[model samples]
Target: MMLKRVAVIGAGAAGLCAAKHVLSRLNRFAPPVRVGTYANGRPIHSSMYRDLRTNLPKEVMMFPDFPFDSRLNSFLPHHEVQRYLESYCQSHAIRPHIRFNTAVDSVRPVEGEEKTTTWQMTSSDSSGRQKTETFDAVFAKCHSSLSLSPSLSLSLSIGEVLHSHSYRYAEPYAGQTVVVLGAKASGLDISIELVKVGAKVTLSHRLPRITYPLPAGIQQSSPVVAVEDDGRLRFQDGSVSAADLGLEIQDHVMTPLYHFLTPPAFPSLFFIGICKMVCPFPNFNVQVQFCLAVLDGSVALPSRGQMEEEVRRELQEKLARGVEHRHLHMMQLEQWDYCDALARLGGFTPLPPVIRSLYEEVWRQRGVHPQKYRDLNYQLVSDARWEALN
Candidate 1:
């Protein structure tokens, strides 16, 4: 049997893991090909910021098969993580298979004999050279965009409105009063950075009032709902903030996925790392292994109708548990069980129990000391155990 021709798009964390696993199983797979749009002078989609350090410790964030350098800090800067990914790529000899500076334009499924899918993908390099390729299996990223109300969309007319996605460094806005929106990870990190740079920050959010001791220069306020007629900011509680400029943090895409792994109708196409509130690297590890099993016929998939029914039933169960529709994909506590189920179904070794235990400990610490949890460190030892250090 000829090895399957597989195409993996987006050479990020998940893509790299998929490629690594594909290369290891030579009998059932060809050399995997990857296409990514993230290079210098190319379209930027990465969330890395210049001065950002990971909120989670490296012990909890690293891939199970590959560990970070033993000498580096537990909470590493963005560049360190990038370097680690580069090292992983080199260690696995995955660089030669990637198409650098290439962007995927479209992926259309061509049905073949017996209802099998052959993916026809079109891509263009930075130099505008286009190429079309057909592959036996395709792994890609899912794209979604959030819909802003007209009033909020018009708020962009205000003098300076910068989304955190575009924010790389905090120096340019020093000494300026900035209104940061959203109180989640990026929002909180950005707020703290601005305050350290002599910038006055008004943190606006929809969540309950933060009880933690925030930095002195930061002030908390209600979520920003709209812009005033004069271009000032209006909050959800009818309050307004007057500031020199503004900074907002928001996700570009929001859509409901039928299943976290792959669509029932498109078993040959897998979307990885789309779930929110996940331990990313380990999550990618489990997902790619499961997808590989699906591709090589080790794990038999259900019929299309049955898959669709399972999806509906899963969503209904989540709703019955009082989970909001918007949070259907937020699998914070559910990820462990999900990983276990996938491992059992695919006949792969499950993630070590130490990872989940350490992750849960970090979550508890984050609740008690949101801003200081990073000061803690951990060392993973043999026998699925981790030791906490000061």
Candidate 2:
């Protein structure tokens, strides 16, 4: 059987990585497959901010086969990571497969009696030109929606509101009181950045107040309860703050995934980079290889019923253990095990020990000093070793 074509959605790190892997291993499959990528923006619309730097160091953040420039800092700015991705695509000959400024409309299964089914994708470019194409499989690497709790919904006229998605810099909110919702990484980072530029920032979340020492202009608040008609922000603990702007850090919730890959009902469709708190580039590398293995008949999946049942069981176990549904896919300390499982299942090499050690060290550093962690430097000495260069 010939697996003639594959479609990858999004042009970000995950999509580019998938395209590179598919193109490189075309000879492994019975028949060579052609891959194409669809991106919604011209230069790529990633959720990167102007002052953002990667929390994970470049040592473990790179694809296993393609290392970042050795002279680059361990913690690189967002543009450097973007440039690394561009370089990866160019080096792997993936540029020819990319279709920029094209947004995917829908992907659905083409139903038939065959055991292995095909997929149909509809996409439209900026010019409003639409095209429908069919392929043996589809990989969706697009960004998911931010999970906003229902209690925090406010009227449109309340005040200036924005998701972290639209946040660029801190100068715009200088001298104004800003309430940032969701105290995740972005929430903490943005709050710190805002305070550096004179924004009175309040970081609010449902979780326990963080014990870290914040900058002078920044304060911690209880989770936001409601927005009053007078533009005051009410907190769960009955505190109120005069709000001029609101920024919501997008939270990701697992969407009933099977092994964090595909929905059992649609085996031909897959998603990458949905898991949180993992080394993204390395994770994408393993996931793409495993997905390709499944496609080329190298790995056999269980029946649809079995796959769906397993997903339910996993979610139930997590909920029983006090894990929220929204955090089901968060692989903070579990990332190493998860990556090893994918490698074992796909017949690929497991994550190197050096990567795991560096990842754990960085995780500890972030907790110890969230504000100053990135000041540390690192060097990779071998597959199983790394050194902290202070």
Candidate 3:
């Protein structure tokens, strides 16, 4: 069958990477796959606000063949990464396929039992004219977090309880006592970044422990307890500072649960860039591991329970050996990152059963089975693999 035109939703790392993979192998296609790119915003790689440098190094974050400019060091700033994405697209000749400022309105299967799907897209042009377009099959490149509509409001002041989405430059929050709510990588990174810039930062979450990066450059360390959460954050039973972070984790935990419990409410988009995997062997290898999973089909769109089970199996084997297990953390983080990147970029959530099953079928057919299908013998967030999962 002739491959229909594929529409890639987001222009972020994974979306671009997926596009790159397709473009790289375009010549192999018999019908010549036509690719089109669409995104809500003009090209904000993950909506990276100010003070956001790649958590992973340039070497790891960069595409395999195309390296970052030699002059720039490892940690490329957010803008630099955006610039790199632009360059990557240019160097790979992906610009012609991209459409900026376009948004996908709705996507549903075409009526009647047909293999083809229809994407009814509504977008506006520079002239303020609205237009609708259709595509055969679309890659919902948006992130998964978008599924949990920002509608859920908490008792915490609306101004105070902001999902990582509302966050941008720290300038507005310079002197005010700020409480960053999240236990995930983005929460941790944003909190640290805020603290670095002289903001009294408190990361509020339920996770009893956190894997902290030490001063000696040791990637791993014993779990640290966060004390002083009323707006201030004290670590490892250290002295308390002013303004403690709120320790309310119920909402945080409930967010993911809500997503799972209410499928219709919570879009099952992939979440990526959760954390950087630190193997003493190489370094921050999150992006590298992500690319591998994508290419291997171990991780892909439309997450399925079986596919997730397969992923868990691989985690068991990799995590079995403390050092080797670092790869598992890397892969897991990439999975989360992909979810987020896809939703933000694609403007659609995979929604369980459909998208997840799609990923399962694709991964299974691609020989991306779990390394080991048995139950995990040990816990994932343990001491041994801490460094590997930095």
Better of 2 and 3 by TM-score: 2
Model 3, TM vs. native = 0.53
Candidate 1 yields a Cα-based lDDT of 0.81
State model 3's lDDT.
Answer: 0.42
Summarize candidate 3's per-residue lDDT along 1-390 as a digit string, tens digits. Answer: 343344555556655654555565444322112224444354333435667655444533455456678567554567887788788878877776666655544544453343323555565544446766664434443332231323323333323544565467666655556555445546655665555556665554445544433122112112234433243334343544343222221121211211121111212222233333221101112332333343334544344454455555645655665634312334332444444443343333322222222223323322322222111111113212211111
Deviating ranges (above 4 Å) for candidate 3: 1-3, 25-46, 111-120, 126-128, 144-159, 196-198, 211-390
Q: What's the best-to-worst order under TM-score?
A: 2, 1, 3
- Global lDDT scores for all candidate models: 0.81, 0.80, 0.42
Q: Evaluate residue 374 in candidate 3 and report its C-alpha lDDT on the 0 to 100 scale.
A: 15
Q: Which stretches of candidate 2 lie over 4 Å from their true place?
A: 28-45, 142-151, 156-158
lDDT of 2 at 357: 91
What TM-score does structure 1 among the candidates reach? 0.92
For lDDT, candidate 1 versus 3, the one ahead is: 1
Candidate 3 C-alpha error for residue 101, in Å: 2.1
Best-first order by lDDT: 1, 2, 3
The number of clashing residue pairs in model 2 is 0
Candidate 3 C-alpha error for residue 285, in Å: 14
Of 1 and 2, which scores higher on lDDT? 1
TM-score against native, each model:
0.92, 0.93, 0.53
At residue 233, give the lDDT of candidate 1.
85
